[model samples]
Target: MPRKGIALVISAPSGAGKTTLVQRLLREFPQFGYSISCTTRQPRQGEVDGKDYVFLSREEFEQRRAQGYFAEWAEVHGNLYGTPLAPVKDSLQRGQDVLFDIDVQGAAQLKLSLAEAVFIFILPPSMTELERRLRSRALDDEATIERRMANARQEMLESRWYDALVINDDLDTAYDALRSVFVAASLAPFRSPDLPEALLDS
Candidate 1:
């Protein structure tokens, strides 16, 4: 029988290489079920609905939120983003790990509900490198870049709360570090049903 799956949460500030690492992990790890989130933002070029995000309008997002649809939800960068409870619970029930790409605020909320989830924080090597990388993307204006840098710094302060920290100085090296954590988590004894609860209660 397949074992109970774990919740894997990866969080990083914008432009800190969180997306790249998560994308690579999902591509390589077939067992992980992607937790596609619902977002109130307009779709960026090439983004697909129900795949990249659920793509809800603010009204629709709020409507669902009110109906008790979200397991955890938060507003980030002035946009509401939520992960529906149904999909995540379904994956876990099927013995497939659920992967979450979320912000620190959402991470905090998730901890209250899923205390055993594995949390990893991705960080840029330095503020200088992070600024350089953000600018290189050419996706936003200088003012927007500055705001992101500030946000990145704020998020970095919360890295202590995570189980592991991976610095994205070199992509391959960082990816390897990240994969190592997954390997270790997969081996955790808690996943084994043979370990009786009486052992813990004693």
Candidate 2:
């Protein structure tokens, strides 16, 4: 029988290398399921519905939230974003580990709801490096960059609560550390819920 899968919830600041690490993890572990969140925000350019996000109207989002459909939900800059509980549960039942790429706020909410999940926080090498990386993107204005920097500081402060912290100074080193974390979590006794019973039966 297939073993129960895990929820690997990872959070990082905007400028951190969270996305890159997640992409590498998925590429390395193709069996892992990527968690697609639901959002009330309008689709951005080139963002496909259901793939990028399960776009919902305010009314539809509220209705589902009222019915406890979301595993975790949070509002950011006036837009609602949530992870649907049903899909995650289905993924777990099928023995496919689910990966969650979420912000610190959503990560906090997820901890409360999904206490069994393995939470990891990614951090930049330093504030200076983080600022440099953010500016390198040229995706945000000065004001937005400053705001994100402030947010990053706050998020790092909260990272203390996570199960693991990976300082993304070197891409290969960070990825190795992250992979180690996942490997350890996967091997944890609790994760193999069926092992003891199976061995006892034999």
Q: Could you give candidate 2's per-residue lDDT for residues 1-202 as a string of tens digits?
A: 4677889999999989898999999889888887888999999999999899999999999999999999999988999988998888888877889988888888887888778789999999999999999999999999999999999999999889899999999999999999999888888777677887898878
Please write out the lDDT profile of model 1 over residues 1-202, one tens digit for every residue.
Answer: 3467889989998888888788888889978877888999999999999899999999999999999798799887899988888887778767789988888888887887677788999999999998898999999898999989988988899779899999989999999999898888877776756556646776
lDDT of each: 0.86, 0.90
Q: What's the lDDT of the predicted structure labeled candidate 1?
A: 0.86
Q: What's the CA error at residue 92 for candidate 2, in Å? A: 1.2
Clashes of each: 0, 0
The pairs that clash in candidate 1 are none
Per-residue lDDT, model 2, residue 150, is 98
TM-score of each: 0.80, 0.89
How high is the lDDT of residue 27 in model 1? 84
Clashing pairs in 2: none
**Where is the poorest 10-residue window by lDDT in model 1?**
190-199
TM-score of candidate 1 on Cα atoms, chains taken together:
0.80
* Residue 97 Cα positional deviation in candidate 2, in Å, after optimal superposition: 0.7
